[model samples]
Target: MTSSPSQRLAWPDVAKGISILGVVLLHITLTVPESKDTWLAAFNVWLDPLRLPLFFLVSGFFAQKVFRFSFAELFTRRLWYFLVPYVVWMLVEQQTKRVEYHWVFGDPVFDFSQMTASLLVGHSMAWFLHSLILFNLFLWCVRKLPGWAALALSFSPILFIAWQAQFTSIAKAIMFLPVFVAAACFRDAISAFASAIEAPFKGEWDYRSFWAYSGMVGAYAIGFFIRRTWDSYAGAVEVTWLLPGTEALVRDDVHILVRMVEQFFEVPVGIAVAVAVSYIPVLSTGLRFIGSHTLPIYLGHPIGLTVLYGYPMALNPREVSLAGQWPLENTWFWLSMCFVYCAIASLVLWALGKVPVVGWTLKPPPIGASRRTTEPPSAGLSLSQKLTETRNATTRK
Candidate 1:
């Protein structure tokens, strides 16, 4: 029996859902004072390799379609999809920070200088949006070049930055661009592999399923060990065998070099885990819902965490620290806080997306300026409806 189109799409959505959840968990683990040094923090570290890289890889998986659009269409879509949100959210984040600063310090001072700097360089968490816009433009500009040459050109800066340990948002974008481009280039191969993995499960456990399952476990295990070692070393080590006279180089430089090497292995492991996890229907279904609205969840989760934790910390850092130290002593409590923040953020965004004008903050605007129809916004669609529409569109194409 053949798998339905919806079934085929589920894994990618699941993968994305997992990635976004990891991102949210990572932020929570890092942001909450209580969670520091707990097992939750260690879990977050383990998840670090899978989080953003998987997100970018998935984005890349869809890039082939975007690459086909005309310049006008591309501009319109990207503007609505990335740039507009980036600008709007950056302003919102900065304004929130300004207010937070004042409330915490008992001084109503707006730091124009810092805001101006953020504008020039991408704002805090909003950098991902800024980077996405730039990556699209960069890829388009080099579209005429031979594929290998284009990839090489795109990768050069990333290598330089990685070696130097200079990790600005722009550098991070450059680092991840190759993954995105590779996905666009090899979408068919990936799709086919996913299909092969799913084929056996449609009937009964077979050799293919066994190998697929084993591969998934093996990849995840390798990734886990890699992350553990990377953390153990703090990305700094002497490699006299790898490079002669490298002892002269500073620990930071060696750390960056080790990180660069670790990523080369880690990203593929993330992709493998994503593909492997997709075969499980129940897990996929739950994650698919979260994956579908990742944009809003991504933008809103930090705000939710900030509101929950940041205010109290700002008001009385020492008091908040002492209070957090106790509850966080329980590992389960720390883990639950991560889930709670993510759930709260998702709910808040979902609620905001239901409103008319306010929904624009969470969902992409309609493609053209003219709103000729009284139809509801796309955000209102159920998961099944969205998946069906996607399948129909893929079939039509």
Candidate 2:
């Protein structure tokens, strides 16, 4: 059932909040070898299964309209939403890469032709947005197909794994297409399931305890175990499926069993995370706020990350493994810095988006969009408006 206008579907935002925050933190720590052994790293690793899966899942949930939208409608509402940032940020980041490449690799090397080609082929640092474009386009193309046929066709990309190897470039579109399609197609069922989980927590103390502890903690513990032993599990189960052909065909690194296990865990892990977020009223609201502004953080954080190269990130070479060292190697402080960085990027861009010319860097001009097209279903709410509503809800509460 659709939520009432007065009520919000809180979990999507919270899940997105968790995913985006983890993504930024993961990017920040990408160069640090010691970080891999930290508890914060484990926390990030535990979230690995939830990270992209949940992002693509909730994105497809929100994009259920694409299944029915006309091509024009798709372009205005969805395509524009992703393409703007994908193109604009990739362009911006390319500039950063020019300087960064010189610093890291001992001389600058970037081809403009390659940049344009990569953009056309959906390759960029903003890969999430790129994959979304491809996924949405696929949906639009398949919109006319019969239900079962469309559903069946969506699985075609999962077959691409047969061609991917640990050394080769991955097709992210194929890697994540099924998750996106599943969420878009099965959003109602998933939302209903999530709500059913949260319902217990909203009731009596006994029910709440059951959900808050037994339910969420149990899921987290399982996820923690799965993540901690992920390497061993993947290494242990290495069955390669070559296409129905000769030895020249591409190889699959880990078997289908690994993917099956990971995806099986994703559903419960995501639901548990959402339920936990909703039960914490104060924290949930804060996460929802962060989630709402994900576009800003998603676009701007990469630039912030690239800009911080020489400062927080220091390179230390070892014979066996090249490692990155942080000046102040405190895990808690590093974790705290990640949050502050995301928060600052979101806020600064949020404010700059109101500035005429400068705003283009963050939010693109909604091309081919009418005024109504520009006004999304939510039409967006300001922070002050949300605060006002909270204050006014006191009597109702």
Q: lDDT by residue for model 1 over 1-397, one digit each (tens)?
A: 1235334466667778988888887777676555666776778777766677777778877766555556776677654678666777677767766667787876565777877788666757777777777777776777677667766776655334433333366456555767666666667766665665666556656675677657666665665566567667645454333433233555554444444445545665565566567666687667888888788787777776666656655766643342445563454454566568667866887888889988777666767532336445345589998888789889999
Over 4 Å off, model 2: 146-148, 162-170, 204-230, 233-252, 255-257, 311-339, 372-397
Task: Please provide, for model 2 over 1-397, each residue's C-alpha lDDT reduced to its tens digit, 9 standing for 90 to 100.
Answer: 1366667778888888888887887876664445677766778766777777778888877777787677887998778867776888777776776666665676546678867876776555677777888889987888777656766787675555554543122345544566777777777767766766766566635554455446545655665566456555533343444564233332243433344346545556776677678679799988898788888787777766566533235253232212333435554455456566656766776888889977766666666643363443334568787677667778688
Q: How many residue pairs clash in each candidate?
A: 1, 0
Minimal lDDT window, size 10, model 1 = 238-247
C-alpha positional error of residue 152 in candidate 1 after TM-score superposition, expressed in Å: 2.4
Where model 1 places Cα greater than 4 Å from the true spot, the runs are: 1-8, 105-109, 159-167, 203-257, 316-338, 367-397
Each model's C-alpha lDDT? 0.66, 0.66
Give me the overall lDDT of model 2.
0.66
- Measured by C-alpha RMSD in angstroms, how accurate is candidate 1? 7.0
Query: Could you estimate the TM-score for every candidate?
Result: 0.75, 0.76
